[model samples]
Target: MGFQKRPYEPTLFVKIGENGKMLIACLYVDDLIFMGNNKGMFSYFKRSMMNEFKMSDLGRIHYFLGLEVVQSNDGIFVSQKKYAREILNRFKMQHFNPTNIPVEFGLKLTKAGRGKKTDSTFYKQIVGSLMYLTSTILDIMYAISLVSGYMECPTAMHLLAAKRILRYLQETKDFRIFYEKGEKADLIGFTDCDYAEDQDSIKSTSGYVFMLGTGAVSWSSKKQTIVTLSSTEAEFVAATACAC
Candidate 1:
């Protein structure tokens, strides 16, 4: 199809037809999805792909890569409700009481926290599941990242915090990230940091979320590599990371 690999996005390929029709394709392992402005060009491209490979058209994808997509008159929504429920059942928290926030305010997890050691295997599994949830559930990014730090040797306190995140998920399982379709394609990003948030390491936490108009396209929550003495410096470092 003479498509060129999209810069900065390795999985995406783009091609502009002589008729001014643009086609974009994204590949994830064996799954491929097509999007284009021209109907005729889109159909032709689909036919070409079918002839070249053994593929089935799922048509208006509802489930892909563990993310559930819902199409509506207003916009498209993505979620992971089924996965969230599975996590809850696996951890025996399916009927757990719901919580308003994923993480408690001023909560600081430490390596030297006083608690019994938890099963590393189960702790890692919970963290892994929550990490996947972060793909669509942006609100839990910070909590997931926080609990993930103790995957190697999680304690009872850490496990309790991880379960709180699950409780939060149970409360907002139906929430989805809506990507409304419109002409606007503006890209905006926000960055912030907490100075010396980590008690043990004395490292700051930096987080950023990028939005394509109203829908988030990318996001991250992690500790800074280097320690910053001032909040202004911490914020600057976070903003630089987002820009990069």
Candidate 2:
């Protein structure tokens, strides 16, 4: 009952009771997720909600926003197998051969690549869908973001690359991020960058991934704003960005 809205995350609310039990609730549109370490408090909170609102208790969170959660004695595993399959089929890449890697190593793409222009509308649709899929599928984040750079004027080569990501998704659709119970939830992050990887502008790309326990909670792959003269400088830029 003493729950207050979280300062940083707007939709999250938290409360600490006299017994030192902690409870949290996250609201997104009409959906709500409740989490707490105290079972008695959780039951009290659930009862209060049922008394005040017309809502259905879906039991434990198995699926949310396309993420499938599998609970076990080991811990929890989250994935998007259904969503990955849907997107692969939507883009007509379900039958394509899967690859071990989403993008070929040392592959560099540019806006000036010589190739036939692809259907802008269809290319954008595929890119957008793949971008959404990256929420639970971090392996394809870099590849998706790379191909997305050319969404404004995608070419045949760019489309092919995007489909390759879908193929990777098709192959690894069952991949899950396991959040082992009792594991330290300390936030750990890693950052790296390539010096002048973008061939067109010769600008570097910076990337970072933050994890809680063993599973990633946030990640990003973006182009650096200024030209970095050396790999050392590029790494510095990436580390600074991740620190932020």
Candidate 3:
């Protein structure tokens, strides 16, 4: 009953233990998922939840919100293989040839009036589908970030880039992020930025990823608002954003 709601993440509740035991629970609407190092706390919480409301115990989480979690004796592996395939089929790219990379090297996407105009609606859908896959497919983060910027007025070039991403996904749809058990739990973070990569506005893009133990817990890739004079400044901005 000593559950404390987190200020930043209000939907999450935690029971801190001084005796090296703790419980963490995430509440999403009517669904409740909780995990802990103490079995006693789990039983108590389950009993309390059952007494207060009518709910069924779904047991261990295998799938939730398009994310599939495969739990083994050593760790938990998270993936979106089914979702990725569905995306490919939804856009009729399932039978297309797979690519080695999501985005081509030295590819500089711009808003210049050169390529033929494509359906903005369709392009948005493609970019949106790939956006969620970034939840586990870290490799496509930069590519998704690039294509998402063109959603407002996507051209044929943008559409092709988006398709390339799906093709890349088709090639690497089985990728998963595994969180393995370890003697120590360390938080590690990485930050990167492309100096003036956007030709239209000459803006830099910043990206960051933070990993807890063997799996990434948080990440972001976005075009920076302000332009930096040098790569060093761009990197600093990216790092500062990452720290925040």
Candidate 4:
């Protein structure tokens, strides 16, 4: 979506006949997702669109939104291996030793005298790269979220934590999400929150992920904007945010 705000204007429209069904196509800037039951109908729709505007057919949808998709007789597979490797090489992390985990579990990262002033730029650069990488690499979500806390004024400890995430990526560079042909098409979701997780602001962080079949289709992680009176309230708010 464009960042600028303007009056409403309709650029695309759809209509369906009473006896005929129409496919639903959702577009966000250049990214699009199309759903339809009839292959013939989709083909007709594509032809009409092509007649109206000049477009190039990229052949079957193999990649979109930084995610690489591979379709086989068995099913479809999605991965960001190329994007991950690019990030690693861009930050000069590809040659480093790989780690088993993105971050140490139960590790509390606090903003204090934990980092050195000389490495502030390096820390920011790493975090920014990781943030870009996380757009398609959901497995790195938690680690990137944790390391992002120190962006304001990073320390040596924070830099180490961010580097650990990169190292973890180095180890799991080939991982991908596979959607098999026989798997049922189902939508499921999970929500979680860490109360007062941020030591400095005492603000809780809420996260949720929604899966379709075997792949994560949507997910988010955000800090609570308002303080909650109790744990229950915090949980309720986080759930509401997740639902929305």
Alpha-carbon deviation at 184 in model 3, angstroms: 3.0
Per-candidate Cα lDDT values, in order, are 0.88, 0.88, 0.90, 0.77
What RMSD does each model have against the real structure?
1.5, 1.7, 1.4, 4.5
Among all windows of 10 consecutive residues in model 3, the one with the lowest summed lDDT is 106-115
How well is each residue in 1-244 modelled by candidate 1, as lDDT tens digits? 6999988999999999876789889999999887888988878888888899898888888888889989888888999989888888988898889999999888989986659998999999888888888889988888987888888888999998999999998899888888888849798888888899888789988899999977898999898999998999999999989989
Off by over 4 Å in 4: 1-22, 26-35, 118-121
Which residue pairs of candidate 3 clash?
Answer: none
Which is the better candidate, 1 or 2, if ranked by lDDT?
Answer: 1
Report the number of the highest-TM-score candidate. 3
List the candidates' TM-scores in order. Answer: 0.94, 0.93, 0.95, 0.81
Candidate 2 vs 4: which has more lDDT = 2
Tens digits of per-residue lDDT, candidate 2, 59-89, equal: 9999988889999998999898898888887
lDDT of 1 at 210: 91
Better of 1 and 3 by TM-score: 3
Higher-ranked by TM-score: 3 or 4: 3
Which residues of candidate 2, in runs, are more than 4 Å off? none
Clashing pairs in 1: none
TM-score, candidate number 4: 0.81
- Per model, how many backbone clashes are there? 0, 0, 0, 3
Q: Judged by TM-score relative to the true structure, which candidate is superior, 1 or 2?
A: 1
Among these predicted structures, which one has the highest lDDT? 3
